[model samples]
Target: MARWSNWSGRQRSKPVAVQFVRSESDAAAIVRTANSAGRTVRVAGAGHSHSPLVVTDGVIIDTSGLAGVISTDAQQRRAWMWAGTRIHALGRALHDAGLGLVNQGDIDRQAIGGAIATGTHGTGASLRNLSAAVVGARIVLASGDVIECDRNRYPELLEVARLNLGSIGIVTRLQLELRDAYRLREQAWQAAFEDIAPQLESLARATRHFEFFWYPQTDMAHAKAIDETNAEPVYPLAAEGERCAYSYEVLPNDRPHLHTEMEYSVPAAHGLSCLDAIRTLIRRDFPDVRWPVEYRTLAADDVWLSTAYQRDTVTISVHQDIAEDETPYFRACEEIFLNYDGRPHWGKVNYLERETLAKIHPRWQDWWQARERIDPRGTFLNDYLRRIRPR
Candidate 1:
């Protein structure tokens, strides 16, 4: 058996077989073969997701072989790329074509398909998650059928494919709506948590991108703000640390350290109170929790499975060092988030089951219906999907 593990080394699996596919046809063939053998099939991208979305005992389709830019339309500001293209590579490719992703998360190591599938996002009150920018995609179904979907084509299916949790089908290629290449100005500073907590709402409304990392054990918080600017790039002194660069270059940060993370989205109105409660709990009980808790805001989207579905959200992410036991901490935080009507990030760690998830997401059943239409046999369903999305 071939062993596989996630980026954070929290989830591991030993697949019966791992096949590296180079094209859509290759992926289709693998799916057909697996179906014929009565075995399940799952596709693995960069394996950045903390959840066991890709863990499988059957055949594993590795998509890295089907990578790179396929086509670009300058007039329409759209680009087509293979699903396996990494976010960083996509950024550079689009930049060369005078285009850029509308928004991106801090970590750029995830494959484009995986990122969109999991509803990955960045910090921006006005900007939507990466899934919203997906205008079209080519998905290979369980029976080896290739379906092309977009707004003009299978509009309904396009919605399902946008934020698919690998339960619908394997996305072979994607066509994304891009923005004209732009520059951004970023400023970062450290401040006390109490001082910034009260002003977070106004700051989020005013800035294009505003997020912060608050240390649970201390009163310190690292705040960052970014905004689109027409000014030329500048190099500032150490004291006046401001960076001006291309949108992609300035958005992603280098994360050399690894940790297990759990993130949930709450109603924008109750976000601050939730954060305050979490801070109080951590300080009073889990004194050993030292990792910073990240906070960011996101605009709502129509994607069915999106955490910010149909409502603006404030996302809170709690992390623990790789060496620490995250069970107690994550469970406690989950309880707090659930009190505020939180929706967990699909790709991150969480203990929510189907019954609970259905209660929180208004379109949960709708998403499952779409999943059944494309993958009736559940060929794409792995153990993780089966546990959370039972038949």
Candidate 2:
């Protein structure tokens, strides 16, 4: 047996065997063998997810061997990439092809498939989550069969595959709808929490990307805005206050600190109130919570399991240093979020179960039906998946 842990070191697993797969056939064979023996299988990517989504005692298929860009089509603005490609690597490859990812989160260490699988996203009023950019995918099923799905082929399956929780199958390749390479000008500064609270909506709509980090116990928040520009790239270390750089350079930052995070998305209408409530709770009840609270927004998408599904959303993320116990703080925040009818980010920490999730996601039943059709034996399910999305 081999031990595995996520990037945050919060979730761990011991699998009977760890197999590094380089192709679709390898993944399919592992799944088929595991299924035949009545055992479950889990695919481990970069392990960036804080959730126990990858924890399994069966066979573990490590997808790192499948990394890299497979092909690109400039005419259609599409790029086919192996599932294990890291977001940072994908960005560089796309830049070389005169294209770039439509959007990406601040941390670029996540594997491409894992990022989209959990509905990972960046902030912008008009921008959707990364899963929304997935136009096609090739999933290897437990029966040793590979299925290629897209809007034009197996469209219903494509919808489910877009943001699958890795329940349907092992996604070997993804065809992302890309955009022409672009440059962005970013401005970062500090602002009083009260001063920025009321203007969140306007700021989100006006900027290409807008996000903020509120330092607990302080009245100030670090706000950042990134907008497209035609100007020359500005040195990232320039002290002129504003920096203009390629999309990839400006979008991601060096996250030297390690922490565990819990994020939830509430309807756009309840965003402000929820944020205010969280701020008050932290200031009054959990003064010891030192990690910053992150705030961002996302446009609605049709992906059934997406946090922003069918409704524009405001995302709030609470983080705690890896050395501290996050349970109490996260539990309190989860209560406030649930009051606002928030949906938890799949990859992040959450306490929701199937009944609660079913209430928030209208398409929950439909998504389960699709999963049943694709993975009848539940070969991809782990304890975490079974709890949140019971069959």
Candidate 3:
């Protein structure tokens, strides 16, 4: 047996075998062999997801070997990369080809496929989640068949594959709709919570990207904003301050694997009140806990299972240093989020079940139908994902 644990040292799994694949055919063969023996198969990327999405007792396929920029189309503003390519690597690779991602989250360690599966996003009023950026994918189905999907080819499948949560298939290559190469100027500032809370929406609207970090014991927060610029790059990028560099270089922060996180997206209108409620809960009960809360925004997207599906949203994340118990704090925060109609991030620490999950996503059944079309035999499903469906 092979042992695997996620980035946070949580969500461990002991699979019967672990195989690394360098090509689409290899992944398909592994899935086919496992299915023949009635064993479920799960693909593991950088293993950065905090959820148990990758936990399985069956065979584990490591896709890191199938990584790199494959091609670029400057005129169409699109690019294709192997599924296992890391976001940071893609950022640099894409920039060299006169293209860049529409947006990127602060952390860049996740595999492109994993990040898309989890509906990850950067902070911006106009930007949508990474799932929304996906224009096409080459997937290996449970039956050992390959499928290519895009807006014109199997368009309905493309919509489901956008945010399939790894239930659809093993994505070998991803086609991203991008932009002509660009640079960004990143600036950091501090502000009191009250002042910043009320202005989050306005700030998000005013900037290309905006987000903040708030600690439980403090009334103030560390805030940041990034916007495109034609100015010269800044040198000596400190731990924090200012920098002007390629969009990829400036967009991703150097995030150490310090804390495990819990994130949820609520309606944009409810962002401030939810923050206020969390602050009150933390102060009145968890005063000793000092991890920062992250606040960001996502434009509405149509990806069925996306946390921000069909509605503009505010994504708020709470974290605790990995050394401590994050349950009580995370669970309490979840309660408040649910009260405000928040949807949990698929890759983060969340206690949501199918009942609650189904209620929030209007296209719940449609997403399942898409999954059924891809893997009706449940060959790609792990016990964790099985819970995503109603009994």
Cα deviation of 312 in candidate 1 (Å)?
0.5
Model 2 lDDT per residue over 321-384, tens place: 9999899999999999999999999999998889999999989999998888888878998888
Off by over 4 Å in 2: 235-242
For candidate 1, give the lDDT of residue 92.
81
Note the Cα lDDT for every prediction shown. 0.89, 0.89, 0.89
Global CA lDDT computed for model 1:
0.89
Q: Mind giving the per-residue lDDT tens digits that candidate 1 earns over 1-391?
A: 8988889888888988999999888888988999999999888889988888999998888888879999999889999999999999888889899999989998798999999989999999998999999999999999999999999998888989999987777899999999999999889988999899889999999999999999876779899999999978664422222778788778888777889899999999999999998998899889888899999999999988899999999999999888889999999999999999999998899998889998998988988888888888889999888887845
- Which runs of model 1 end up more than 4 angstroms from their true locations? 234-241
Report the Cα lDDT for candidate 3.
0.89
Q: How does model 1 score by TM-score?
A: 0.97
Residue 315 local lDDT, model 2 = 96
lDDT of 3 by residue, 1-391 (tens): 7998888887799999989999999988888899899999888889988889989999888989989999999999999899999888898789888999999888888999999988989999899999998998999999989999999999988998888778878899999999998988888999888778777777889999998998777788899998999988776654454888888888887777567899999999999899989999999989998888989999999998899998999999998888999999999999999999999999999998888889998998888887887788899999988877755
Q: If scored against the real structure, what TM-score would every candidate get?
A: 0.97, 0.97, 0.97
Q: Lowest lDDT 10-mer window, candidate 3?
A: 232-241
Clash count in backbone of candidate 2: 0
